[model samples]
Target: MTKQHIGILALLVIILPSCSYFDFSPDLRFCDDFYVVVEEMPVLIGGMAELQQKVVYPELARERGIEGRVTVQFIVNKLGDPTEVQMVRGIGGGADQEAVRVVKQAKFEPGKQNGKPVCVQYQLSINFRLEN
Candidate 1:
């Protein structure tokens, strides 16, 4: 192909990925079908401290002396609500459930792509430890 044609093709390649052809739909069928990264990732509304305050140490876990981190994966939607929370890593003894509970109750500032709110996959780890 001519240099002019090649140049035009290269320009299209650069522009197409950011175009409406990849439009986001809030009604997407699959929960995993969300952006992993965006121009601005979602932030917890009151930050991690606010979410940590919501955690209730499970009696069984506390009694058993189970202490570790529970990692949760979820999608922060355009509305800044977490959905589809799943445990990525868990230290049993009810810590998994507690982690999920707190995450579901948390709110966030929606992630942005091209200055528009978009769904983004996010991961957070909550630590459980016995206080002296």
Candidate 2:
């Protein structure tokens, strides 16, 4: 087995789930209704240290030499639960699935705009690295 780390970036954070599950269709009005360019981005409830403890590096990924960053896009609702998790880019060999698993289980603080909690789109990248 190897060591891995998860890095997250808040690119294109929309208001919330405006479309169906995993459906990021182009609808100009959707942004106004549910999307929000949040001023205060969501945060992991317990921080990265908590996430690091919960993440399980898939053994399959380690044995197969599948290592890299897996970028996942998802929506964090006003209640801070991640939904509609989507893998924008992945390294494959179970790394993608594992990334999704971690994101789904992880909780956020819920993005805010104008001092009110709102939904937002989120992207997180989990890196798979082999121990030397």
Candidate 3:
């Protein structure tokens, strides 16, 4: 072969090895039933007396005797702790406080991501009922 042809072949050989170094292989898993079931327990409310005490029953609502529901969202940490409680839906008076207080005081079993327990966002709904 001509020197020029030989040099070209040698250059191709040098470039091929470098190209192999960039080869990527990714791990993949497949399952016929790729479904994972997660069972969530019901969050307990009215368990903390301190939280109950902080709930404000609006005098106006009490006079009118309005009973409603409040929805709150929060994060439960990997340590099975609750934090960042905010009211998504609020009812005037002590209902909102009651919702926040109860949520903050409530404990969670934490949540799982990929079968491992991790911090997760949780939502809670609290109902305020006034007894005559």
Candidate 4:
């Protein structure tokens, strides 16, 4: 067991295990998440009035005087169904949940690119206003 041989063995052990630590994790660095320009934008079937009418204002929100707008972000699939619905901004007292419920029930006209339907990310803001 020479000192040079011992030194070589130590280097080999330290270097070999460390080499496996690296990983090229998948990422969306090159992804075009949203289309800059599309042939059409996703649109709710009936519009705001319909949504307002459909919403069941949270009783707790009305009682506590909690009122505001909830912003939701979702992907409108090629079939015009909302997917990946997420609450971007929320108001308490169940107003946020009510808004989400109504919005999720909505149907949209899918956005198109080059005359073909495409997944489109859309943001919708729903107001929870207490009627006086």
The residue-by-residue lDDT of candidate 3 on 1-132, one tens digit each, is 999999999998888768966654431211122112235532344454544555666677688777898899776665566667899998777677768876776765656655555556677677777976
Model 1 TM-score, all chains together: 0.76
lDDT of 1 by residue, 1-132 (tens): 999999999998899878998764456323445799899999999989889989999999999999999999999988888999999999999999999999999989988999988889999999998997
> Per-candidate TM vs. native?
0.76, 0.70, 0.55, 0.71
| Regions more than 4 Å wrong, model 1 | 1-32
Could you give me the TM-score of model 2 versus the true structure?
0.70
Best by lDDT: 1
Q: For model 4, how does the per-residue alpha-carbon lDDT over 4-123 read when each residue is reduced to its tens digit?
A: 999999998888767867644433222235563478988799988998889888999989998888998887777787777888999989888887888889998888888877778888
Whole-model lDDT values for every prediction: 0.90, 0.76, 0.65, 0.81
* Residue 39 lDDT in candidate 2: 92
Give the 10-residue window scoring lowest on summed lDDT in candidate 1. Answer: 24-33
State in Å the error of residue 11, model 4. 58
Q: Write the per-residue lDDT of candidate 2 for residues 30-114, one digit (tens) a residue.
A: 2324444689998889886776566677888888877798898887787788878989999888888888998889989888889
For model 2, how big is the CA root-mean-square deviation? 19.4
**Predictions ranked by TM-score, top down?**
1, 4, 2, 3
Lowest lDDT block of 10, candidate 4:
23-32
- State which candidate, 1 or 2, has the greater lDDT: 1
Model 2 residue 91 lDDT score: 87
